[model samples]
Target: MLDAMLPVILLLILLYVGYTLVYKTDEPKKERKIHEDTQEVKEKHVEKPKKHVAKRKNPVETTAPKKQIQAEHPLLVHVLKGHTSAITACAFSPNGRFIATASTDRTVRLTLRESLKSKNPTFKTINLPYDYATACSFSSDGKTLGVVTADGCKVSLYSKFKTKPECITTFPVEHNVLSLLLNDIGEEWMTTLTIGKDDNTEIKCWNTSGHLLQTVNVNQIQNYHGVQSLDNRFIAVAAYTPEVKIFEIQRAKDGSFSKLNKAMGLQGHTSGVTDIAFDGSDFKPVNHIVTSSKDGSIRVWDINVRYKLQEDPKCIKQFQAPSGYYSTVDITPDGKWIAMTQGSALYFLKVATMQICCEIQNAQDDDITRIQFDATGIEIFVQGTTSRIIKVYHLPIE
Candidate 1:
């Protein structure tokens, strides 16, 4: 019986050891299965989210074509490259077929219209040397070009050189030419290149035939400089003796000049006169005179009454420059943009709202000397110091 009890205890110990070993092995299997189930559930949830994802369309790959800009609001299309030196002056021929640019390079170029598609559309250059060109214009027929010299104080007339330009005639003037104009038919006018110590202001008129038509003398004014004539009947003159003056100059058969019997004079600029532009189309939006001064301001006035000092020339608008002394200023023919040079920078202001448009920052540093719009108001040409080339800008039509 003792032996039987010992065997039973030994059996009980073996059973207990077996139960412990089995429980430990099964516990590991159970935990592994639960972990696997949890992993599967997590994977299923992640896969569900992926199946419900929304696709996105790329903006660069849009299906519809973009709308084009309108004609009245035409966009800028950069075209021809311009001058290499200080561009003294620029103008578009009345026909808009070519652009004339005058520079301290002592040359003027006739830039042809090339398709903007071309990567390079440079001007077919024509060489004309004046002492230094300050003012320039194309004859109405676009056949001749006139440029004033800074040193020689003369007017050089250039005719087309095989559809390019060639200097055909030159006339000597005792004074430097400050301003000039040639009408649709080559009718021309010129004013002081040098304000004389004589105190007699001189503005001369000529015809396409190269005949002197009138000589205007204004002893009362210090330096009479700009002459702009319309329809060959009405003449506008801007002068300075530290003051802005406008006088009506009349031409007679004897080739004599006289201030309008009853004239209008304007005085507002605090410094010497820099520029004046006449916009016949904007006769009402602006006065006949828009003058820029070293004082860094522009004053627009209606000197239509200047012959009569008692009659006030309407001070329509005044725009100030952003920085630098006002070197030069011009208004688009339609009276849209007023561009002025301040030191080495170019500042453009919208006439309608007097808004500053842009300060053209070239990767290459150059002083922006002069700015002018094309005849059709489509482009701007600029030049200045350290300038090796002229920049032509395609502009907005609106």
Candidate 2:
């Protein structure tokens, strides 16, 4: 009986040992691994949710929309880069469909104003007779363009319809031509010449046939620029002095240009006047003359009251210019604002209040030689001094 009892007890002990090793120890190890894995998964889920929530609460949502909006509305709309030398002058067609540019490379280039950024932009370049093309202007009828060389002797007129602009005509002058002007009907033109040692310069008006119509003598006018009013009844000249000379353009009863009469002088600028601009088309004369001066001031004058001022020409509004010489000034087609350039910067001023609306700092790589507004005044073209590039800027909507 003792021996049987001993065998049974031994078997029972072995079974217990086997049960503990196979079931209890292995089960606990498996459950521990599952628990550890579940805890790791839970921790991962918690961290992931926190990261997502933090991202949603932080700049991720705000900055994304802002970046998208900024991408959609770029300040710089287009860049034109065909010129091989420094650009001297730029003028937009009256219809606002094209822009003509003159360069020291002895080239006049026409670019479609609307398609400047297209894959194959439409541009026509004509080689000029002389280098250092100084200035250019478009006739208000959009049918012809006039370009001048630095010597002020050769003036080339081009017809827009021709492919090569077969040398429309050349007008000879005695002095270097500094500025050129064309009438709205494309019938008449005017040019300003460089001053000589005798402190004398000539402002000549010519008909379409290149016949000189009227010649007015101006004394000591330096860096002179001229523009005709929208009605073509007045021509305003600004130079390296505070006084701007106003001339009345006389027209015949049959609507032909006759001659120029010295009207008066606008005196306000303390230093040399760098640029001048008219408000709108000559058909609807605004009688508003905007001017920029080296005195770092931009002044607007009402020509309607130009003759009333006894002493200094009174400005309707005045504002300080950006840093550097106020090299150029242009008014929008709508006559609501003025665009001025000093050095590489472009400044926009509200016409009514003379408040600075916007400023594009260092808008170009070099000096801004010219500035122009399109027909709608929604875009601006800026030409640089030596870069030979035209930068198009879109006016920001209020």
Best by lDDT: 2
Weakest lDDT window of 10 consecutive positions for candidate 1: 189-198
Q: Candidate 2's residue-wise lDDT over 1-398, tens digit each?
A: 99879989999999999998889768988999999999999987784543434334676656655444323226788887788888888887877778888888888888876676688778888786545678888776677788777755677778854465656777765666667777644444333222221234568777656677777876645646777665556677777668888777766776677667777777777898888887767456666778888898988877666464544345788888545568889887567889988788888888877887788887887888778787667888888878788888988657
Candidate 1, 24-72: lDDT as tens digits: 9999899999999999999877845436657798877877778895442
Q: What CA root-mean-square deviation does each model show from the true structure?
A: 11.2, 10.7
Clash list (residue pairs), candidate 2:
151-176, 152-176, 152-177, 230-282, 231-282
Q: In model 2, where do residues sit more than 4 Å from their true spots?
A: 1-73, 129-132, 184-200, 306-313, 321-325
Question: What are the models' TM-scores?
Answer: 0.60, 0.74
TM-score of 2: 0.74
